[model samples]
Target: MNSIIHILQTQGNDILNSIGQHITISLVSLLIAAVIAIPLAIVLMKHKKIAEVILQITSVLQTIPSLALLGILIPIVGIGTVPSVIALVLYAVMPIFQNTYSGLTTIDSNLEEAAEAFGLSRSKKLVKIEIPLAMPMIISGLRIAMVMIIGTATLAALIGAGGLGTYILLGIETNNNALLIIGAVFSAILALIFSALIKGISKLSLKKIGIIFMAVIVLMGGYFGYKTVEKPQVSITIAGKMGSEPEILINMYKDLIENDHPNMKVSIKPNFGGTSFLYKALKSNSIDIYPEFTGTVLESLVKTNKDASHDPKATYNLAKKLLKEQENLDYLKPMKYENGYALVVKKSFAKKYNLKTVSDLIKVENKIHAGFDPDFYQLKDGYPGISKAYNLEFASTKTMESSIRYKAIANNKVNLVDGYTTDPQIEEYDLVALKDNKEFFPPYQGAPLVSEKLITEYPELKATLNKLAGKISVEDMQKMNYQVAVKHEKASKVAHDYLVSHNLLREK
Candidate 1:
């Protein structure tokens, strides 16, 4: 219950931040859409043939998936607000343009004829007669566009565009129901309020109500501006794999700093998806920091021309040298121990077969069913690599997510499973993580990677994280992992407790 409340509070703030971003994206896009759409509608009203072609084009754009459109736009516009705004504007165009055309064209020709008969000039007929009658329809279209943009705006976060989508995406990724609800509810509220205000204004005299409505909006904007200015802004971008561990780690960092540095606000932008995405975020300076493994830095990023070695210190040196010289990035001191893959078997199964190590696995390998995570099984460095290196084959193989595989092993559905060395369940379930006599897997020491610019700007930040070096033993990490993955404890709380217990955080 306490966990539920804490999650709600955190997500509420996230939603608040998201609301601002969503509004910015929606309004900016709508404004741009109106500039282009209204003019097109005007031209269409004047030319019947052109109107048909343009409307068809907009209808086609509307059919395109927002996510796909954003993907197509990413390379051209790159990431962040620009592509997001363009996508939203494209989405907003059909309704506004269609409505504007319909509203202007539908006016009884008699009304227009009367304006001309009254000696009204062309400009007067348009400004005084045509637009006024079309006002309600145009407002109606704007309202529809506003609602549509709010819903579609959630996709913006996927491409690094900041907005309320952040909370929604985070909630979905972490399975935090509270965050999801908060983001959904508040976004609904924003759309509702805008729609209602527009509806009310459409009923009143435009000349009379317009100034007052604009004044009120400006006042609200000013108040929000003041509130934002008064609060200290501490912005930190964290890049990590989009998974349970990174989510917990980022939350932990947020809680620790917020608790200790009350006056110093902190914001954590989590880039969660895959290693490649996080790496790009770091390289582009879209993210300020992220957790990385030494071996990945050495093998994947550095590509050092050296034979594979399992020694942590040796790998660390290679990673550090390559990062400094080639990438202009720095690898902070590694955490206590390496987190590598281990071939695990349930206690009962191990005892039944008298299995102890990789060599022993070969003896009973033909009898055992193996389950691997889909990614792990498919990756070049995964099961295929292990099979080639160890020269062992299983009776049957199935691919699944790691969590599902763990459950399968627990239920005796599979006799052999791949497990992370630092997984807390290894200890909890009494599973044996067999030693790799052939050293097929490489070292994976956790560390923080910072860009050269960030290192120079925040000199103390690297040292602060480095203090964690050699402190978190494999056993310690397992316990922390259990607190998050099993016990359902908030990752931030677990991380904060660990930091305070170890005297890494100053007393409040």
Candidate 2:
């Protein structure tokens, strides 16, 4: 508990920023849903058949999985707040409209007759009598929708939309309970705050609620308008895949580049999404650069035969060539360390099984219960190729996230799991990496991959980037990862300390 408090105190700035983003996303999503669903509900109130059809359509939208919806939106609209807001709006519309429709339909006929008898116009009657009568139900619907929006907005982090979910996901990845607790607690608090606010709004007159909403809108607009006129700077966006290593590497990239070029502003979108997400973001100019492994580049970004050579030099050269020829991406000079995949197990288990190599796994294949990440379960250079190369198949397999697999193995829930050579948890959990004698997986030397547009615009960035060439060995990476993941240190601090100590960056 003391450790968690310490972490919270140290990460106060980051948590506050995440809270601001979380509030903005939640409120914006609910506001948009209100604009669409409330008016639609009003129109549908007089038409029973149309109301049923529209409600059914919205229900279908609600049923679409959040991830599936995000997946569909990414290629079309790209990542970040736009897609996140759109998906949340879709989920919110159903609840908002359904509750609103119920409220409008339940308004007493006597009240409408009284307003009609008072010579009130249709719009006037709606404002005077019908609205007052229906206000409770309408506010009820908004409260439900607002609470839903706040909770669901956490998913936005996966698409580079900043929120508390960033911590939540990172916590899961690093097996850090403090981070997980902070994210979950803050998210719940946001939902509760909105719910309380809506309850208070329900008690106030309609005019007061309208005033409050307009005030919020005006403040947000003014803030953005003011920001729009600020002094301009050359901004470059750098993104990375999930995990501490990528976050640390991007932090180094940011520090090195910004320290050298004071006029430049570096925006980091760490843990933006998966490999495909980052690649697409780069292609779309959403991100300028991200650290990618040579193995992933060869396997995912480009096509190759099943038996592509796993040699470090051969793979790096081929990846560099193919990326340039195919995607116009420039791969920086490779770092010294290789963060390649291996079949990992407890030291005791490996000793018991005499599992010294991937070939050795074949002998006890039926005894192995392995957990792997989604990509490893399906990718050619992963399970499929490993199975073919060694003629091995596990007795049972569970597909899970990269981070969860480590804890799963450590807890003795699964006997075998996939691991990157530089994962801090491998050392923390006392696990051993089984030798890949068959060379089924490619060498994953890290390098910064930049879009052509970025380099063309800022050609000097190449020099700053290449400064990391042949730097950061496996042991060095593991130590940095441990500091950030286990010690709960900020990635930026860890990265900065490493850079200064190694003379990679002068203290400025």
Candidate 3:
């Protein structure tokens, strides 16, 4: 409890920012869903068969995993608010539509007939009788949708929409329970608040409802208007993958760029999914720069399996040249540390099995289970790399999220898990990384991967970001990751302090 309080006190600004984004996303999505579902339900009241068919279809659509849906939408609508809202609306529609249709159709037939006998026209009967009687049911549906939206809105942070989920994912990555609790507790509270608001709106008269609805629209419009009023001269958005290190590195990028160009604004979207998502965002010009690994470029992005050098300098040079030639990207000078993937095992497991390298894993391949992330399970530099190089395959393999794999190994749930060379958990959990004696995995030196347009617009960015080139040795990165993930220090503070300590930033 004290730890949570301390985190809240120190990180109050970031917490508030996340809350604001979460509220806007949930409320806006719920409003849009209601607009679409309520009217369609009203129209479908006459066609019960059509309504039933539509509801069933929506039910089936809801079963599509939100992450997969987002992945599908990223290339089409791009990431952030649009895709997040669309996914939430698809999930929200079924309940609201179902309840609204039931409310309208289930109306006491006697009242509807009496209105018809009293010479009320069809439209008038719907306006005067059906809508008023059905208001409570409609409100009830909205309440249900609102709760679900609030819960799912956390996923928005995965694609840079900014919500409490950012804290949740960061917590999971760094093993910080305080951060996880904060996100979950706040999300629950938001659900309750929205539910209460929907209930209150249900009790209002038509006049009161109109007035309240107008006030809400005016408030939302004014807020959005104010948001657009002040546009920065040069706005730069930096994105990162899901990890403490990416978060820390992007913070450093922001601090460095902003310090040099006070006239410009830099936005850091940390933990914006993995390599594919980040690359797509960059390609769409949705983001300006992100940290990319040389090895990832060869194996994942460009997929140039031929002539992919394993030597650090050679890989960096080849990647830089190829990226510029084909992708129109700027690969900045590489950092010193190599965050390559490696198979890790618990100290006890390594000792008991006498496992010390990739080849040794062959002995226990059929005996031990392996846990790895989806990217590592499928990517060439990951599972397939060793399988082809060492002629090894695990008897059973389970794919989990990046951080969960680390936790799984520590808990003895899995004997071996794919891990990054610089992950602090390797040290925290007393795990040993098997040597890649065959050199199947290439060196993954980190560097700023910038868009060509951004570089053309502000050429000075190259010099600013390149200050860390050949800096941040493997030990330096490991220590920073440990500080943020293990010690629960703020990544921004960690990055800033590292810069100041190393004289990379001018102390304010």
Q: Give candidate 3's error at residue 101 in angstroms.
A: 2.2
Q: Is candidate 1 or candidate 2 better by TM-score?
A: 2
Q: Model 2 misses residue 458 by how many Å?
A: 1.4
Off by over 4 Å in 3: 1-5, 47-64, 75-78, 121-123, 231-234, 343-405, 408-417, 430-438
lDDT digits (tens) for residues 1-508 of candidate 2: 8868988888899899999989988887888899899889888889999999999999999899998898788778877888999999999999889988898888888877888898999888877777778888888889888888888888888889989989888888777788889999999988888899898888988788789878878887787678678846438988888788999999999999998898899988877767887888788877889999888887779977744676899989999999998888889899999999889999999899888998998788899999999989988778887888888878999999776898899888899998888989978888888888877777999999998999999999999999999999988998898888877789999999999999988887
Candidate 2, residue 125: Cα displacement in angstroms equals 0.9
lDDT of 3 by residue, 443-471 (tens): 89999999999999999999999999999
Measured by TM-score, the strongest candidate is 2
lDDT of 1 by residue, 240-291 (tens): 5644466555665555545544544555555344465566666666666677
Ranking by TM-score: 2, 3, 1
Q: List the residue pairs that clash in candidate 2.
A: none
- CA lDDT scores, all candidates in order: 0.75, 0.87, 0.88
Error of 3 at 159 (Å): 1.7
Which ten contiguous residues of candidate 1 have the minimum total lDDT? 256-265
The better candidate by TM-score, 2 or 3, is: 2
